[model samples]
Target chain A: MELICPAGTPAALRSAIEAGADAVYCGFNDETNARNFPGLNFSRDELRKGIAFAHDRGARILVAINTFPRASATALWQRAVDDAVEAGADALIVADIGLMDYVARRHPNQRLHVSVQAAAANPDVIAFYVETFRARRVVLPRVLSVVEIAEIIRETTCETEVFVFGGLCVMAEGRCSLSSYATGKSPNMQGVCSPASHVAYEETAQGTTSRLGGFTINRFAPQEAAGYPTLCKGRFSTALGDGYIFEDPVSLDATTLLRGLQSAGVAALKIEGRQRGRAYIESVVRHFRRALDTLEDGSEADIVSLKPFTEGQASTLGAYRKTWR
Target chain B: MSHSSVASRPLPTIPPLLTLAIRPLPLLPLQLVLGGFLQRILRRNPGLLDRLGEHRYARFGIKPVDLPFAFIVEAAPPRLLVVRELPQGLDARVSTSLANLLALVEGRVDGDALMFSRQLGIEGNMEAVLALRNAIDDAGLDLPGELASLFGPLGEPARRSFELARDRLTGPPEEER
Candidate 1:
C-alpha cells in the first residue's frame, strides 16, 4: 500500500519524502485547505519547489483545496485548483461538489481524490463522486469499521484511503458544527476548529483550566497531561455525572490493523498532521514506512512505539474497530 | 541509518555537577551573551517573530530545569535575557531539561512527543506556547550552525567544535548514521 504523509511546510515536505513517504499531501497557506493554522502550509512558490523536491525523490505530491468555499468567493478556490494543477500536483483532494465540478470541467485530465471532508461513507455516495467527477480515490471517513470499509471497497471502483494515525474527529467530517457553535468562526468555512485566538488557558488553585471562546472545555489536575482545547474532546457536566461528554482526548492509531486493512483492499494508508512540525513528520513517516516495508516482505510488523506522540499519551483504534461504538 | 532509529536514540543529559558548578557565577555576562545570540537569530530569520501573530507581545519563560537560571523572552521587538527567577504576569512558561530544550530548538525532537511523555511541562497560556512552537519549527533553526556563524574568522573551527561536542554529548549525527 502507498504511504501518504502530510507536509505543512516545505521543510516538512522534504522530511516526509526523505523518511520514505510514497506521496506527501499538503495545502496552500490559506483557508483553501483544512489545516489553516498560523505558520503552516505552503506558498505557491514553496509548493512548486516542494513538488520538484518530491518528484526528484520519486514521490508524489497531492494538493488539498478541501474547505467549502462561499458562493460569492469561488474565485479563490478556483485559483487554488488552477495553481495546484499548474504546479504539477499529482492529484487534487477536493470536498466541495462545486469545486469538484469546476475541476472536472476546467481540468478534466487532472486526477481527483475525494477528501474525507465530503463524508462520503457509503458506496453509493462514493460511486456518485467517482462516476460524476471521475474521482480516482476516496478518503474514507473515520466512522467505518474494517469490515464496513471492505464492503465499501468491494462495491466501488475507486481506490480507497484510510487514516491510520493522527487526530480523531467524533462528529461526521463535513457536518461538524461544534466549533462554530462555540466560536462564531466556522471550521468548515474558516478552516479553523476552536481557533487558537479564541482559546485561553488559566492556572488556578484548583487546576489548569482550558477554555474556548470563554466557555470552559476541560480542566486538568496538576499531574494530568493537558490536551488541545477542541470542543469535541471537551469535558462537560450532565445530570447523571460530569465527564467527557462527546469524546475522550486521544489520537487514532490503527497500526495494529494493517493486515486487516490490507485484506480490505485499502490502496493507501494516510498519516494525518499537517500542522505538526518536521520532527513529527519525519518520525511518523519513518515508522510507518518501516512497518509497510515489513508487511510487504510477508512479515508481521511490530507497530507499537508511537505512544509518546499521541494526545494525552493515549491512543485508540477509533471506529476502525466496532467495539468503539 | 533509518530515521526511526535515529529518532529513537537516547537523548543526552547534562551532568548535575556542571550545573552546580555554575550556580554561583554572576548572570549579567551570560545574559548579555544570550541577548546577542537572540539578536543574531532574529536577524537571520526575520519572519520567525512575525509568525507568532498577536502572541508576539506575550512574555515567554523558558526554564532549563537542570540549570540555575532561566530565560525570559519578550517576542515583540525581540529581547531575550537570562533571569534568576521567572517574573510575574508572564504569558507562558515551558520547563524541560537543557538537552531537551536544545533538541527542541534544533527540531531534533518532537515537542508534542516530549509533552506527551511528561518530560516537558507547560503552564499559563497554551495558545501562546503553541504559536511560539509553530514559529520556531517553521524557521527550521539549526542551533549549532547558527552558533558557529556568530564567530567571524574562526567560524570553521567553532563549527567543528560544536559538532564534536554535540556528537560526544548526544549521539552521532542522524545523517552520518
Candidate 2:
C-alpha cells in the first residue's frame, strides 16, 4: 500500500519525503484547501518547487483543490486547478462536481482522485465518480468500518484510500456547517473550520477558558493541558453531565490495522495533518513507514507507542473498529 | 485575511522574563542535564542535525519566560546550550511560558495562535526562527519517550512508570472516540 502524507509548507513536504513518504498531499495558500490556517499551505512557486523536490526523491505530490467553489468566485478555483497542473502535480484531489466536470473536460489525461470532502461513503457514489470524472481513486470517509471499507472496495473499480492517522472529526466529512453557524465561514466554501481568527483564550475566574466565536468551547484547569477549541471536541452541559457530547479530544492512529487494511485492498493510507508542522510530519510519517515495512516483512510493531503524540495523549481506532456505534 | 493583516503590522515589545513566577537556583542543574540530553539526542538522530543545519540560528535565544533562564541554540553540532541572559547581536529570540513552549514541542499547541496572542513572542529574524521551528518539529520530541530513552534498557519500565504517575496526578483522560 502507498503511504500518503500531508505537508502544509515546503519545509514540511521535504520532511515528509525525507521520512519515507511515498506521496505528499498539499494545497495552495488560498481557500481552495481544507487546512487554510495562517502561514500554512504553498504558494504557486513553492508548490512548483515542492513537486520538483518530491519527484526528485521518487515520491508523488497531490494537490487538494477540495473546497466547494462559489458560483460567483468560480474563477479562483478554476485558476487553482490550472496552476496545480502547470506545477506538474502528480494528481489532483477534488470534491466539487462542477470542478470535476471542468477538470475532466479540460485536462482529460490528468489523474483525478475524489476527495473525502465529497462524503461518498457507498460504492455506487464511488463508481459514479470513477465513471463520470474518470477518478482513479476515492478517499473513503472516516465513518466506515474495515469490513464496510472492504465491501465498498470489492464493489467498486475505483481505488480506495483511507485516513489511518491524525485528527478525528466527529462530523461527516465535507458536509459540516457547525463552524459556519458559529463563524460564518464553512470549511467547504472557506476551507477553514473553527477558524483561528474567531478563537480566543482567556484566563477566567473559572479557569483558562477557550472560546470559539465568543461561545465557550472548553475550560482547562491550572495543570490541565488545553487543546484547540474545535466545536466537535468541545465540552457541553447536558442532562448526562458536562462532557464532550460530540467527541473528545482524541486522535486517530491505525498502525496496528495495517495488515487488515492491506487485506481490505486499500490502495493508500493517508495521514491527515496538512496544518501540522515538520516535526509532526517527520515523526508520524517515519513511524507509519516503519510499521508498514514491518507488515510487509511479517513482523510486529507496537502502535501504542504513538499515544504520546496523540491529541490529549489519547488515540482510538475510530470508526475502523465499528465498536463505537 | 485577518491573520495576514495581523502579521503585516509591527510587533509589540514583550515583557521581560518573569523571575518571581519561577525560582532561579534549580535552573542550573536542569540546564546542564537538558544540554547533555539534547547532545545525545542529536548524536543519535543525525537527520535532525542535517535538517537543522539548513538554517543559520547562531546566537538565537529560546526564552521560556516563566523559567529563570533561556536556551541559546547553536545551529551546528552540540546544538543546544543554556545561557544566563540573551546575548547581544543575536539573530532571533523565541519567548514563551514554559508550559506553552513544552506544548509547542509536544505538537499540542498551535504556533500561530501563540504568536498572534503574544503568548509566544518572536523578534529579530523571523526567517531564522521559522527554520528553527521546522527543524525542531521534525525531531518529534515526545516527553515520555525522550525521558525513557535516557534509561537505555530500562526505557519501557521507566516510561510506563512515568505514564502511570502522570495518570495518577492528572486524573483520567478524555474518553476515546
Candidate 3:
C-alpha cells in the first residue's frame, strides 16, 4: 500500500520524501485547499518546485483543491484546478462535485481522487464519483469501521485511502458547519475550521480557557495539556454533565489496524496535517514508513509511541473500531 | 516538585549549578544586546513580523525555564526585553528549556511535539503563540548564521564559536542521542 504524507511547505515536502513518503499531498497557499492557514501551504512557484523535487525522487505529488467555490467566485477554484494540473500534480484531490465535474471535463486524462471532504462513505457514492468524474481513488471519511471500510472496498471499483494518523474530526467531513456558526468560516468554504485568527486563550482564576470566536471551547487546569480550539472536540456543559459533549481531544492513530486495512485492500494510508511543521512531517512519516515496511515483512510492526505528536497527548483508533460508536 | 509545580520550575535537563551561575549576571547588558539582535533580524527579514498579522501587537513572554532570565518580545514596534521576573499582563508566555527554544527558532524541533511531551508550557493567548511560532517557522531564522553575518572578516570563526558553544551547552537533540 502507498504511504501518502502531507507537506505544508517545500521544506516539509522534502522532509516527507526523505522520510520515505511514496506520495506527498499539498495545496496552494490560498483557500483553494483545506489547510489554508497563514504561513502554511505553497505559493505557485513553490508547488511547481516541490512537485519537481518529489518527481525527481520517484515520488508523486497530489494537489488538493478541495474547498467548495462560491457561486460568484467559481473562477478562483477553476483557476486552482488549472494551475495544479499545469504544475504536473500526479492527482487532484477534489471535493466539490461542481469542481470535480470541471476537472473531469477540462482535463480528461488527469487522475482524480475524491477528497474526504466529500464524505463519500459508502459504495454507491464512491461508485458515482468513479463513474461520473472518473475518480481513480476516494479517501474514505474517518467515520467508518474496518468492517464498513472492507464492505465499501468490496463493492466500489475505485481505489481506497484511509487516514492512519493525525487530527480526528468528530463531525462528518465536508458537512460540518459548527465552526462557521461560531467563526463565520467553515472548512468546506473557507478551508479553515476554528481559524486561529478567531481563536484566543485566556488565563483566568479557574485556569486556562480556550475560546473560539468569543465562545469557550475548552478549559484546562494548571499543567493540564491544552488542545487546539476545534469546535467538535470542545468541552461543553450539557444537561447531564459539564464535560466533553461531542468528542474528547484526541488524535487518530490506526497503526495497529495497518494489517486490517491492508487485508481490506486499502490502496493508500494517509497521514493528515498539512498545517504541521517539517519536524512533525519527518517524524510521523518515518514512523509510518517503518511500520508499513515491517508489515510488508510479514511481522507485526512494533509501532513507536506517537503520543508526543498527538493532540492532548492521546491517540485513538477513532471510528475504525466498531466499539467507538 | 509536584506535577502542578512543573510549569514554573526549571526543567531538570539543565545543571543546577549552571542556572545558579546565570542568576548573578546583570540583565541590562543582555537586554541591550538581544534588543539589537532582534532589530537586525527584523531588518534582515522584514516580512517576518508581517506573518504575525494582528498578533504582532501581542506581548510574548519567552521563558527558558533553565535560564535565569526570560524575554518578552513585542513584534509590533518591535522590542525584546530581558527580565529577571516575567511581568504581569503579557498576552502569552511559553516555557521550555533554552535548547528547545533555540531549536524551535530554527524549526529543528516541533512545537506541538514539545508541548505533547510536557517539555513546553504555554499560557495565555494560544492564538498569539501559534502566530509567533508560525511566523518564526516561516522566517527560518539561523541564529548562528545571523550572528556570523554581523562580523564581516571573522564571520566563519564567529559561526564556528557560536555553534561550538551551542553544542557544548545543549548537546545533540534527544532523538539523535
Model 2 C-alpha lDDT per residue in residues B16-128, reported as the tens digit of each score: 44465455566667677777677766766554554444454356788876556789877565657677688877777788766556556644444643542335556555445
Off by over 4 Å in 3: A299-303, B1-17, B39-60, B74-79, B84-93, B116-128, B151-161, B164-171
lDDT of 3 by residue, B1-177 (tens): 000001111224568798998899899988887887788888898657666777888999999988898999997787999998899999989988887787677776677777655577787776688768867765767888888887788989988998887666556443445
Rank order by TM-score, top first?
1, 3, 2
Report every candidate's CA lDDT. 0.85, 0.76, 0.84
Model 2 is docked with a DockQ of 0.06
Provide TM-scores for the models: 0.91, 0.71, 0.89
- Report the C-alpha lDDT of model 3 over A44-155, residue by residue, as the tens digit: 8988999999999999999999999999999999999999999999999999999999999999999999999999999999989999999999999999999999999999
How would you encode candidate 2's per-residue C-alpha lDDT over A119-235 as one tens digit per residue? 989988988899999999999999999999999988998999999998887788999988898988888888988886676666545666777787989877654544556888898
**Candidate with better DockQ, 2 vs 3:** 3
Error of 2 at A115 (Å): 0.5
Ranking by lDDT: 1, 3, 2
If the candidates were sorted by their DockQ against the true structure, best first, what order would they fall in? 1, 3, 2
Name every residue pair that clashes in candidate 3.
none
DockQ for each numbered candidate = 0.42, 0.06, 0.30
Off by over 4 Å in 1: A204-207, A300-304, B1-20, B47-59, B74-76, B89-92, B121-128, B153-157, B160-177
* iRMS of candidate 1, Å: 3.5
TM-score for candidate 3: 0.89
lDDT of model number 2 = 0.76
